[model samples]
Structures are given as structure tokens and as C-alpha cells.
Target: MLNGLTDAGSYLQGVSTLQNRTVILSLNGNYMAAGDSYYDGLAALGICYEDYQKGGAWIFENGVPTLYLSGKEYSQKYPIKDGEIYVKSELHNEDCEDTELILNGKNYSFVENGLNILIYDQDTKQVIDHAGTDIYVSFEMIREEKGE
Candidate 1:
């Protein structure tokens, strides 16, 4: 029952399973995917591969693949599921007083004095303040794309 992309940081932390799938992204982004073999070597964090059709590009390194989406490398080692929750956090300034957050793929850039906030959730499409929380997202919520 996972939803959509929740928070970036939390989602990255909570990925459990890995599978082969196609990721449709903007022309300027990269995609990654991971299968059973890739997940076995990971004891803590995992790595995945991503492919981009528009660019006719496939990046593979050490049996892991990755794609740069929107100027960021989206790791395929992490599995995404529907109704899953995720969060992304960014510093507002060098002072570290203000914070910008993204949850469930949505963006929130008006948080102040917020630390380790729950920025996104795929299932609920909601972003909340996660001060001292560690959440994991299930890989069953993502749909498998064709030709992946």
C-alpha cells in the first residue's frame, strides 16, 4: 500500500528489496535498478543501476548502476513501493537555522529550526516534522515498468 515518493533521505534509508524495473524520468535525469544479485552484497547500504532511454545511456560500475535525475544521482539499489513514505531535507543556509524539506515527492521550503524532519511519504503524500525518527519504506509499492 505504498504511495508515491515521500522523502528523499528517509526513503533512501528505508529501502529494503531490489528488483529490475524501468524508471521514467525527465530527459536530464538518470535512472538506476537493482536485482537480487545486487542486494546480496550489501550488509548495510545497497547499490543499484539505472538506465536512461532518451540518452541511450547505461551507467554500470562494479555491477551497480545509477542515473543522474535532476542533477542528482538516484540510486537503484533502493527499492520503491507504492504507498511507501520518504523524506528529503536540505539546509537553508550556512547558519543551519532554516531548513527546506521534501516529502512524498512534494516540496516544503519554509521550515525553521527543524532537524531530521519527515519530509515525504509515498503512501500518504504527506510531510511531517521528524525530529527523532527512523522510518523504512517497503519495496512492494512500486510498479514494474516494461522492458526493464
Candidate 2:
């Protein structure tokens, strides 16, 4: 009886995680969001896109789709559910071979090699929560915004 209850609890938890709309940022290539490095509009912000040494992977999952920076030694394990997934995100990085975001499934992630964000209007409620329905996934390929 206790075991059955525990299993049911797990099932419910999984459902909540799947249905919840959110963003998951999992970065693998060199990330340079901080002020230590500077960039200009004409020039590209240099990061680990080409020189990813291929030993480590970055994974971030709070309440959204899962992502993976797969390699020969390492691979990400996905869930079995729809929002949560199970199978193979299996791919090599730009360092080893060409990288593709998805082989199968909806592009709900809207993920890119650089950064992904959420955009929404402030009229409905001011600051929008991650789970709110008014948000849109915005992927910034390069840090070329005006005024730095």
C-alpha cells in the first residue's frame, strides 16, 4: 500500500513537471555574459563555440524541456514523458561535428547555441512569471544589441 502510494505520488509529480510551461537553459559552449569580456556590433563575442575541449557538459533544468551537449564520453538522459523525454539527444558539439538542436519533437525549447530568454508585455501584470502564458521564447544568437 505504501509503495503504491509512493508510485502514484511520483506519477503526479512527473505530470506537473511536464505540463508546466517554463524555460530550461543548458549551456555547453563557452559562456561570456559577464563584464570581464567586451564586444562590438561588428565583431563577434568570442566564446567556446569552436574550441569546446569535449570533456564536460552543462545542464540546467528547473521547470522546462531538457537539453544536452552530448559527446563520445558523455550523453544526456531524457525522461519518458512528452514534455519530459527519453531517447537520445545524442549529438556531438560544434567542436567535434555539426550540432543540431532537435532530431524529433516540437521545438518548444526554441534553444540556440548562445542564449534563450522569455519576452512579454508588462501591461497585463507588470513582471511576468516563468509559468505565465503571455511569455514568448526569444533566442539571441549573438550579443549584438545596441548600447551594449
Candidate 3:
């Protein structure tokens, strides 16, 4: 029937894109996959981290992650997913007390080790984690190096 065919087409489309789509993520206390609303927020900030080589960065301040681009401050958001303490706006900034935003008992900057950037823990000063592979960032850098 016509209804059956339509359902099959929809299912196939979902399967194809869902498996290979590249998600745009923003780093807070954890990695966040940006949805349409988040992209709108980023646009409001007037900076885009969607590209590599011109990728944005985050600086933790007062237990909050302030977003940056090209070494300048942009906007920030607080996203709470699956009970992890991610960044928040000023209204909920006080709620960060439950989260260990402090690195090694004090604030620390991200350390660059070649192409990888490491974030340290507040109490131990050990490399707690780093961002996942940002393909756009890598591609942009490669393009720049070749002067293309």
C-alpha cells in the first residue's frame, strides 16, 4: 500500500543519516552535542566554533566555563544532561557547588600536548580528560598549512 511505502522511506532516511551525521559539540564540564537551539544560542553570541583551526575554546571561571573564539570571550551556556554537572549561566552558577569544577583544588588552564588538549582534575592535577576528535578543526588546520 501507499502508506507502507511512505513508512519504509522514512525509516531508511533516518537510518542513513543517523549513522553518519557529524554532530556539533561544545565542551563544558563534559561534551555536549549541540541541537538546533544551541546553534541559535551560538549565533546570538556572534561566534561560531563549527569550523576547525578557528575552533573556539572554553575557560573555566568561578566554576563556570566561559566560551571563547579566536582568544576572545563569547557567550556560554549551562547544559545538564544525564545528571552530569555541565556549565550553566549566571542564574544557576551557584548550583555548581555539587560539581568538582576546580582542577587540582584550584583552577588550571588547558594544556596543549601536540594536537591534543588535556584538562586536569582539581584535586589531583592529573589529566582528567580531553575533547573528542573534532574533524572540522583538524581539517581547517590542514587546509591552512597547505595555504589552501
Best model number under TM-score: 2
lDDT of 2 by residue, 1-148 (tens): 1112122223223323332232222232332323112122101212244322331233223343244443323444444223332222233554432222221242222322323222112223221111101112222132223332
Candidate 1: residue 38 Cα off by (Å): 20
Q: Give model 1's TM-score versus the native structure.
A: 0.21
Candidate 3 collision pairs: 52-136, 52-137, 78-87, 78-88, 103-122, 104-121, 104-122, 104-123, 105-122
TM agreement with the true structure for every prediction = 0.21, 0.28, 0.24
What are the RMSD figures for all models against the true structure?
A: 14.4, 15.9, 16.3
Question: Candidate 3: where are CA atoms >4 Å away?
Answer: 1-55, 61-63, 66-117, 136-148
Candidate order by decreasing TM-score: 2, 3, 1
Model 2 weakest 10-residue run by lDDT: 127-136
Question: Which one wins by TM-score: 2 or 3?
Answer: 2
**Candidate 2 clash pair list:** 79-85, 79-86
lDDT tens digits, residue span 1-148, model 1 = 1134343333333432222322211211111222222222222223322322211212222223443322222222223345322222233344332222333353333223211222233344333223221112223223223232
Instruction: Give the Å error, residue 124, model 3.
Output: 1.0
lDDT of every model, 2 decimals: 0.27, 0.27, 0.27
